[model samples]
Structure formats: C-alpha cells, structure tokens
Target: MAMSLWNPTKRNSVVLGLLSPRAMLTRWPSQWIGGALADSFEACVDVQRTALRDAGPAAFDVLIGSSWGGAVAAALIAEGAWTGPAVMLCPALSELRRHGAIEAIVDQIAALPAERKAQCLIVHGDADETIP
Candidate 1:
C-alpha cells in the first residue's frame, strides 16, 4: 500500500500523489479470506513478482509504511517481493486482535524467511493508543 514509486518529477508528482491514494481503493482486495491471512502473505509476494516480472526491475530508494500498510510492507519485503530500505511508522500490528481479526501480524513477520528480512526503521508515537 505504500507505493509512492510511480514518478517523482515535479510535473508528475502531483498526479502521482493524487493517484496513489485513489489507488488504495483499488489496491486492497474487496474480500480476503479470514483464516488464511498468514499463509497468503507469501502468496501476495509471489503475485507481486509475477506482476513485476514483465515490468522489469525499477529503482527503489526506500519504503515507508504506516499502520496496516506498514505490516503489509514488512511481509512483502520478508517474502522477497520488495527490495529496499524500509521505514515503518505507527504500524498496526495490534489491529488483528483489536478488531477480532486473525493472528497477530508481528508474530507472522517473525516467522518469515531470514534472508528476506533486513534492518528497518520504525517510528511510533508513544502517545498513540495503537501499539502499547
């Protein structure tokens, strides 16, 4: 969900910013299977690889993810779908339990392949009630 990599030129930045948020509506699936969220994380990475295969490799300066998006980004990187420096801010690993969802995202990430994980940047506000 943290896809700011469309185009960074001044001419295109505006359109890119606007399109990015709009794409969020299109990005997430309408319905995700409830119990299989964990198993599907890697599957998503596979899909990403397939989608990007024909597109060719592109420059990725860094990845910045917030809330649920951050968790997803971590999973994507851990599954080898993305290769770049990452920044996770106010990540929503607790949302799964908060909303009566499935297992915790943090736990899932802890189980990812060691090769896919790398040093990352995380920033969370202490006052934020999300992550205690």
Candidate 2:
C-alpha cells in the first residue's frame, strides 16, 4: 500500500510512503482472501524492492512494515535496496526459511556492515507465534 501525507509547511509537498500489502489485510480482509496469496515470497519482496528503488531511498524519511511486510523490508535492506531507517513490527523471518531463502537472507544480513544494520529497529512481541 502507498501512503502520502501533505506537508503543510511546503505548500504542495507530499511525503510518499510505501507499505506492504499484508498491512491492509486486517482492514480489508476480503481483498486479501481473494487472491493476495498468489505471489511467492520472493516475488513479493522483489515488488517492494522495485518500488523502493524507483522512488529512491531519499524520497522516504523512514520505512515501516509489519508482519510479512516487515520481512520484505528487512530483505530489501539486506539486499542494499533501501538504506534509510526502518521500523519492523514482528517481521516473519521464518517465512524465509519456508521459502528456502533464510540462509541467504541471514547471510546477507550478517554480512552487512554494523552501521547499516543499526539503521533498522525490529520489534517482536513475545506472544507472536509466527516469530517466536
């Protein structure tokens, strides 16, 4: 999902933000149930990466993603597609394992320079079965 906020001080300036498709599932369950699960995990991440790259990292002040979206954000960061700050809420890193990409993703994240990893903040709840 894409969101834009008007910047009151800048006349017509708008702050563009990108959110994962899953983020809307709660509010729009029917939309998700219809066909949102067709895409592969990697395919979804690729779409997100392409959008972020097209917008350029400078276009966004920060990236925020939840659940599977959080995983996509982390994957983009690990792949060097996004260098901006990010807030990941209960990222489903284990989903990568299910798709057989966990090792590579983990390796990429581990190989990142300390400074790059520091740009992301991850929050996982103790009660989150997906991550726990």
Candidate 3:
C-alpha cells in the first residue's frame, strides 16, 4: 500500500526502497540530481538495514516499495543482496533524475524480465511522466 505517493509500507514484509525526491528536485531552487539520488538511495538502505536489524531473529519475509523506492529495490536486486518477494509501483529506477540524478537506470531495472527478476508486483500509471 502506498503510504504516500512517495512512501509506502508493507507490514510484516521485508522491503527495500529507492525514494523519489521532493517536488523541489523538479523545481529550479536546487536542481542537484546527484545529491537527491544519492540521498534517497542511502536513506532507503538505512531503512532496510534498520528493518533487518529490528527483525533481530527475523525481519522481513518480503520487500515492497513504490516510485523512487522502486529504484532502491532494483539496486538491491541487481547486487544480489537481500531476500524476499519484492513489489514496486510507478518506479523511478528508470529515470535517475527528478531533477535528481544526472542519469537513470530505468532500462536496467526494466531489463530484468519477470522470469529473471525477483518475484514481485510492479505497477505503473499510464499518466506518469517518468516513463521513457
């Protein structure tokens, strides 16, 4: 379930996220894609780590995320790190910059077909501009 358009949580499920930048990333105020991307990526990892630690003896049995978090989820997937089913919606992995990253790995994320990628639930809105 998407907690917000940007953040969502899957209770009792292990999740890794790649969060999107705030709308300001799209605005002219501070259009630094690198920082936003890095920050979001790092924050996501931190959250996952915390969750894993909190799991203590046992944490997540599945992973879930949306938007920018999808990218984070993909990064973990690519690294062959983490375990559990994954879910991504309206992911931003394809486009690194929301005025954030200089580039995106959307193709990389999408490249992994259903057979190759982790068992997951992915959703995309027809009206989204992040699509390439």
Q: 38-112 in candidate 1: lDDT tens per residue?
A: 323334334555654555557456767687556666655555566667788876556534433434445666776
- Which model is ahead, 1 or 2, in terms of lDDT? 2
Best by lDDT: 2
Clashes counted in candidate 1 amount to 0
Runs with alpha carbons beyond 4 Å of true place in candidate 2: 1-39
- Candidate lDDT (C-alpha), each: 0.52, 0.64, 0.55
**Total colliding residue pairs, candidate 3:** 9
The numbered model that scores best in TM-score is 2
Model 3, residue pairs in steric clash: 3-8, 14-62, 14-63, 18-68, 18-69, 33-100, 94-106, 96-104, 97-101
Sort every candidate by TM-score, greatest first: 2, 3, 1
Better of 1 and 3 by TM-score: 3
> Is candidate 1 or 3 superior in lDDT?
3
On residues 44-79, what C-alpha lDDT tens digit does candidate 2 reach at each position? 677788888798767889888887678778888888
Model 3 residue runs over 4 Å out of place are 1-31, 53-58, 97-118, 130-132
> lDDT for model 3, on a 0 to 1 scale?
0.55
Better of 2 and 3 by lDDT: 2
Model 3 over residues 11-115: C-alpha lDDT tens digits?
A: 212121223344244534354344444555655655765665666625667666677667667666554455457887777755655544424445555666676
